[model samples]
Target: MDPVLDDHMHLDPVNGRGVEACEEFADHGGTHLLVLNKPSWHYGVEVEEGGDFQTAYDHTVDVVRESNEVLAGRAWPVLGVHPALISQLVDRGYAPEEARDLMRAGLDTAAEYVADGRALALKSGRPHYEVDEAVWEASNEVMRHAFALGADLGCAVQLHTEDGEDFTEVAEWAEAAGIRREHVVKHYSTGGVVGPTPSVLADREELVRAAERGIPFMMETDFIDDPDRPGAVLGPKTVPRRTRWLREEGYDGALERAHVETPRMVYGIDTRATLE
Candidate 1:
């Protein structure tokens, strides 16, 4: 098998390191780097000239734009509305209604970029710090909009569920919201609903149910090599080992078949090698 695609990676070069990492990834024969955009710390703040904020939702769009401009088709933009930052949307200075509207507009703009062949996928699934019913509801609303746009644009939607229960709830809500399971992909299944440990054996059964229901599941490490990041909970070395383990446990062929052949058929991702 070819070097697996790094399905999700966050390499913002606000300080120049991100660009270097992108070059290194491309040099390593990585076909695509899905750059998941998160709001920059400088979002909502005034910046000097040439320091424009271009993040998809807030500061993230700028990063995507720069990366795409620099990488020239080697990078794919993945717009993510991190769960922990939901409150930031309605914080003191920001208007709740206006922020939500801006978010929708941002997603629409991102979707348009993807539709125009400028990006790859529209993804969601960053970790949440303090989730509640309201947060889930808000996130569901965002997901509904993203799925609708993605379906029309022929792009894929990535979901990050905390655990078994959260996954179940998200699935049910997504179905009720009219999001097709075929267009939604789950990321990082090994992370338990509540923590970074391997999912319970029973949760594996639940995953099978999800798979049988048509939801395309894809695994990813949130960050590439940052131990301080949440994806590090499983440890960097552990990620590939888990991938190998899962493959040995009877899902390798299934994963390859689903994400490779079927995903290409459904999402139009090219499986053939093309000289750039």
Candidate 2:
């Protein structure tokens, strides 16, 4: 069996099933996972409470660290403020400047975690491409902070963004921020275009096309870990399950490259992959 890795998933203290989810993944033949924090819409994380972002940011850091502990060296953490959180704050009457300030603080804290060896990458980027000017600019500034931090710390960033015309535009953004092109990733990529970070959730046909493209990429489910939705984004076993299927169909080379080598090179996450 080829050791498989999930490059992205959310399992915060809000849902309270993150650890169990990781355990289930390992039990199902997964080798590694990257745990992400849910900044909003999980538990009582509304920004209207207490001293605001710092408290939540600290809590998220703890959440990621604890997730690593639960996985017992099988997983690492990707920390940041999701762009949706900032955009919603703006819609909730917070000024764009205020929203950007909070996001910068969150990115700074994530970078500190990387420094401490507690986390691997910063999960930061705009939610989509069609946002209003003010919201878009604020998210861009916040992500700029994340990019600069990733560059300084030699870490990678997983971007959650909407559809766009050209993926190279993203690479240009990373260059302008002084971050390496390999350090930037487009999360939940559909494999519709050629880019560096196309860990696609597309169908078998699209994935085979991506396989033909042969540009190094990773695979993910973006499993939201929401009990209410119950595998809303994707089932937990999706990647490894596909990995096993690939093995059966003689796509082991593709699995090893995308599931192991690409993630290790791009995000610095190395799993215990053994040749079968």
Q: Count the backbone clashes (under 3 Å) in each candidate.
A: 10, 0
lDDT of 1 by residue, 77-133 (tens): 666455444566555454444544555555676676677776677765433555556
Number of the top candidate by TM-score?
Answer: 2
Error of 2 at 216 (Å): 0.9
Stretches off by above 4 angstroms in model 1 are 1-3, 22-30, 42-53, 56-75, 93-98, 125-127, 131-135, 165-169, 172-178, 191-216, 224-252, 274-276
Which tens-of-lDDT digit does each residue in 1-276 have in candidate 2?
455788887765555576667766766777677777677545465665323444544555666566555443466677777888876777888898898887787688777778898777888888674677888888888887888888899888888877652578767778887887766878787655554467677356656766767667777888887778887688777877877776787776777778777887888665653222
User: Each model's TM-score, in the order given?
Assistant: 0.65, 0.88
Candidate maximizing lDDT: 2
